[model samples]
Target: MTTYSTGGEAVVEALKTHGLTTVFGLPGVQNDWLYNAFYDARDRFRVIHTRHEQGAGYMALGHTLATGKPSVCNVVPGPGALNAGAALATAYGLNAKMLFLTGQIPQKMIGREMGTLHEVPDQPGTLRSLTKHYDRITHPAEAGAKIAAAVRAMNTGRPRPAALEVPMDVLQQRAPIPAQAPVSEPEEEPVDAEGIDRAVSVLAGARRPMIFVANGAQDVPEEVTRLAELLQAPVVGYRTGRGIVDSRHPLSCFLPEARPLWDETDVIIALGASARSALQGWGKGGRSLIRIDVDNTVHGRYGQPEVAITGRLESHLPLFIAELEKKGIRGEDLAEVMPAIHADWKERSSVLDQQIRYLAVIREALGEDGIFVDELTQIGFASRILLPVHRPRTFLSTGYMGTLGYGFPTALGAKVAKPDTRVLSVTGDGGFMFAATELATAVQHGIGLVTVLFNNSQYGNVQQMQRDLYGGKVIATDLQNPDFERFVTSFGAHYGRASSPEELAPRLEEAFESGLPAVVEVVVGDMISVDRFR
Candidate 1:
């Protein structure tokens, strides 16, 4: 079947064929036709109009992070794209599967620099640098193939953001689009049998081994757990990899607990994650390292590993387990040692009592399968190593980007993706205000997200650093915050206040039960810094 369609309509049709109907974006004149296409297909799509372009981008990120599926975000070119730049950078950093669509100036206005509406000097260059794949749609006929190609690109290799720019005039142009064809994903590269045998040889002979996981291993939790149990090696996760192995699993360990074990281990199996921090911080002397990742670049990121397998974890892990089984290898059981290590880490981490207390309360309110979006705050810092994650994708972080003010908007997106699952955003005074206006977006769209605002009346982290490093002299760290009660209520959201963790428990419960956009303000003074741990 063939149909005459505008470029915008063609793009929508292509995306729909690819099973993407939810779009997060703020409409503008440059992309008016795209919005029109969206409106016509309203019954087939869920259009989330956000307060800002960044909110749209972040929400798209949250959707993908929670579901491990590709997400879409659309914005106008120039200012709109620039507004969403931070989120795009963060997406790139986290290797998120996101499709970024934007409207360019008129088709003939390319590189003319006439000060036209939403014109940027080098929009294409900027986008290409930010995403793994980028292209432009010049006519309606090109929309389907280009959109399909973009979707395919993000899904393949190391999953990252992809971009497509359609000029305003092109969006209005009409052309014949053929029936959408299935967008076939690229085939996984053959697993390296030689690499797998070498890795297994090292694993099979090791008395003590450690398994480190990151986002790459997120999908193969069972395989990772099976391997860990078979080897009796503790599975350690930090940041994005935290919940790959359940915390209740005897083999599960956090970075803090794994430090001592790192020195004792004879071999390390790094899956879908680079143990970069461990090598840089703890030193990797007297240890043979095996790195398995889809991206070959990661194989030599820090230094060459003893064995590097460049293929999907889904492919390589099973091969490794099968090869080890053939060898009948069994590793030392550290079931008893893990508990002792965790207890020691607990006593050592008591300096972060306040953050831990608040995290515990929020965890209680979130129940078993809820998601927690973290910010670049004191509590957020503690969460990286201290929080107990029971399931994969339950914990969301900004990864290496360390983005501030991403918590609230990201949580809103998570709630949008999984409406039945409770989602909580933890932010501090400074970071919360960055995308604070999104509270309106949440309330208006009926996104029930429980945000725990830690109000310290300042940039707590910077102030603490200033005091500790610069002899108590602080500048511009103190904030004159609005009455949070009024601020939240003004947006027609439920508001609760707490002075301590005990008070926060009931407030969190109330916020979750309300089933509305809610904010729980937890007031605190100067907090103990978790910077040293990092």
Candidate 2:
């Protein structure tokens, strides 16, 4: 056999086997090996050029979140790897299963103390403190297996980002092994019958049973909804479980205000919830708690466990529901609460309804099954309250990282991943333009991702915060723009504009059905937040 492939080739081959088709990266001197690997492997995956290394890292993370696949990003050693720190940290909180491949200065030259060109005194050790896993390969041939192992760890277990460092020389050297199949996540691991029975016992006896679902609930979204129905539990989603239960649903009460929670609160049933990790430890001291994911290592807020079920969320939740049913612990048939919940939802919907003249028309025109992936802050305000997406994953918002500028690119990526989904990105004017170039990519891919620009003419959140905390003089926050819809349309795409409620509906409808990468700019009124959520 010819000995041509090197360590870098092995890593690229492993990534291809895992089904990654596109990788974002910036090349540098120390990364010549992987850079060459990327070019040679161009047939399997395309390299997306990024202006900034950090942007490339986040783009990969965003792709992972949108597709539920490990996205790869290549970075050279030292500053290049350091540039990815912030983005990696954000994805870490979001539970990103991304594979970040970086190159290291050759091992021999690393510590010559010559203060080499790309010297990072202790790159792996430094990054290890910030990341979930960081693997450095000293051998060329083992690159495939080691990289696969890192990906396996990242995809399963706690589900976070993993990094690998390939030495420049080794990447050019011949590898001893060939690429292999990645280790697959197990078929299933159900919730323990004993734990579920115990949890059911607690809920059945309680006069007031409340359910608090967190970001982790998305793993078993159907089970989450079913459990809420089974228990007549007033369902509330944590910041991460935004799309699991329809915000429009009477049971999804964690919106605008924490009213449903304060009224008649008693036992809080947490399924796939991490009190500490989810940052919901507050207000739980007085309330009794029953947690499903019993992995204490998952969070610091692991309180005195009343009931702990150890299993995968998809399996555990179903088993938990089965056990509850067997225990004859039927959810309280509080039709009375349903009516109250419905009344509350109707009132909130009406408030949103009043504000819909500007957006509702466009939303309707887009059609019911239209997919809306939201930016972090805007989506929280608009989509959850305005857009009205009832499907899980259809409304992709930041549950953990809450990163901005994720709007444009993520919509582009999601549209590509789920080609059948009618993808739209609803974004603030400032946020939309951040990764606006992805528009070209979307067009190139032939995916018509509709873009809605919330033209508040400023960094709305910061300006709003200023108004809330300070006297709202609006310093350095407002952003200037040119009929951005026109700007995008000039790039050979459909576009529209709406400044008043009268124009919003018609323009939105027209734009959605137009069938191209379109943008509709909506100039929002100075409507101070009509409602707030904790």
Which is the leading candidate under lDDT? Answer: 1
Number of colliding residue pairs in each model: 0, 7
Error of 2 at 72 (Å): 2.1
Single out the weakest 10-residue window by summed lDDT for candidate 1. 180-189
Candidate 1: residue 229 lDDT (0-100)? 89
lDDT of 1 by residue, 243-331 (tens): 99998888898787788787689898899998878877887788888999989898877666999988899988898999888889999
* Cα lDDT, all candidates: 0.90, 0.69
Q: Write the per-residue lDDT of candidate 2 for residues 1-534, one digit (tens) a residue.
A: 325577777777777777776887788887776778888878777777666676677667667766667788788888998887767777777777778888888888876767888887788787786668878889877776787788777766667788888888888888566547867775455547787677777777776677766656666767887887887777765445556777666666644333554446667777666644222434555566777763446533656556666656776677778877877777667677766765665576565553545446545654555566667444346555555545555656655556677667666656656666677777887887777766665565566777777787888878887888798777998788877766786677778887776776667667657767788877774554634433
Error of 1 at 289 (Å): 0.9
C-alpha lDDT of candidate 2 relative to the true structure: 0.69
For residue 502, model 2's alpha carbon misses the true position, in angstroms, by 4.9
- Check candidate 2 and list the clashing pairs: 141-176, 256-532, 361-505, 362-505, 362-508, 362-509, 365-509
Flag regions of model 2 displaced more than 4 Å.
1-4, 111-121, 187-191, 246-250, 254-258, 275-282, 298-305, 348-370, 376-380, 385-387, 443-447, 482-486, 489-493, 509-516
Model 1 lDDT at residue 7: 83
Off by over 4 Å in 1: none
